[model samples]
Target chain A: MDTEQQVMDHFEATCRSHGLKLTHQRLEIYRALLQSAEHPSAESLHKQLETRLPTLSLDTVYRTLATFEQLGLVKRVETMSSQARFEAKIEQHHHFFCDQCRQLIDFTWHSFDSMGLPEALMGVGTIRGKNVVVHGVCNDCLEKKKKPE
Target chain B: MDTEQQVMDHFEATCRSHGLKLTHQRLEIYRALLQSAEHPSAESLHKQLETRLPTLSLDTVYRTLATFEQLGLVKRVETMSSQARFEAKIEQHHHFFCDQCRQLIDFTWHSFDSMGLPEALMGVGTIRGKNVVVHGVCNDCLEKKKKPE
Candidate 1:
């Protein structure tokens, strides 16, 4: 994965090289995604972009995200939520999902990137990539539980 | 995870002890999950159970799977796919997802279950549970691509 600047540069170059049209909505969506520290679902992105793109439909946000995925501009994350989420395709990183808040926090660990596939898997299948998802309540959620309303 | 017989024994015993209602719908769904060698989406599971459960609705299939998950009888896998898929809670194992065919194959690498959370993750918060998902092209998919249709 790359940083925000790198991702932006790649996004622009890819769009330009491919001759893909960068409509206002698509550009804003990409910018919003790059700025978000957490992977944002389409609905959440739409919420974030409401003031800028007042007329944007949820459907258009969904379609644009899919197009971004096909163009290799973003990655779709399957984080067990009802809504689909998108993350800027940076380098290899893992996610800690705060189930209570439905938030995904990213962290990098070099060991995981170099973990040779165990002998059993390598023998049967070709290994392309892997991700370790540590799923549980985050401190924020746990602390919230402790506090009384 | 446990063996098939053990899982069956636990399932039956748990249902009996908790007085969990096992309607025909629930039992058939459990059997479908247990017998399946692959994680299946609701649509796929419904298709499998259609003949055996002529009156079964897709909604019913979805609801029953959720109930089973809550009861700790099944695990919902959040792989990077559009549809929600599930696994029968048998033992500790990881999934190998084939990008080409959108298929999930299970493999066991015991070390992962005991993998120490790297130090980076330790300082931030509590560690609960983690799953390792290896994504790549499966042998079958590669073989299919090689041959003519």
Candidate 2:
């Protein structure tokens, strides 16, 4: 859903199906997650919403995100960082993280996605999902490193 | 590095090389991380070490782990879970995480490792490392699911 209205509609429907209340805070949180490309953490989300939502507490953001995660409304972006990052986009994709700038970029791997699970993990479990995180320096950071002061 | 003494020797050498003090708490924390296979978070580590070191606080565990991570002595295991997990094993390997049981198992992907980075990721950045996380229900959890109470 590209538009805020579309996202709101989806959010309302999802909440209804899951029997969740369509609170203003929940809508705002969901909208923020949908708009953000940074894969923000709960703390970051709270900070982002604080100006608009002067009364919103960090605890509320944490609880709402946890509830959304439990219902699969949002997916957590796994990273080497201590704080957990999150995304509203739950599509099948991979991530490229720039260690220098600490940017989390999403990229799809059609070949890997089509190949299915690796032979190594065959008998280990009932497979659900797979994610690949590539760590490196992004082009912008690399270029910045190449330039002398 | 299998034995505790071997790990201690390596830890001492690493600490000396990195110009870090060989404090008793740091040594114990490193040893505990080396011994654990759970990819325990700082809170969990603090809980595990508290009885042994009554004065040890969760903040200490967090700070020590961040220091170790900075020094490349310990690596963080990325996961969908909110809490960040850590491991002392720095070798190149991937992980298999059981969503139901929350168990993190290590496995090597020689084929994927040998193949190198995918062409899709080419020209995007200066590649450093890659990790694959497969999420699923472990055999034990699957077996449990099969049996009715």
Using DockQ, give the best candidate's number: 1
* Cα lDDT tens digits for candidate 1, B1-149: 46768777788887777788868898889988999988888899999999998999999999989888988889888777667899885567778888888888888887777777777676555666888888889999888888958
Residue B35 CA error for candidate 2 (Å)? 3.2
> Candidate 1: TM of chain A?
0.89
Which residue pairs of candidate 1 clash?
A1-A90, A1-A91, A2-A90, B1-B90, B1-B91, B2-B90
**DockQ values per model:** 0.70, 0.62
The local distance difference test score of each candidate is 0.83, 0.86
User: What digit string (tens of lDDT, one per residue) describes model 2 on residues A119-148?
Assistant: 778799888887889989999898888895
Give the Å shift of residue B57 in candidate 2. Answer: 6.9
Can you tell me which runs of candidate 1 are displaced by over 4 Å? A1-7, B1-4
- What's the TM-score of every candidate structure? 0.91, 0.80
**Which is the leading candidate under TM-score?**
1
lDDT score at residue B55, model 2, on the 0-100 scale: 97
Cα lDDT for residue A145, model 1? 84
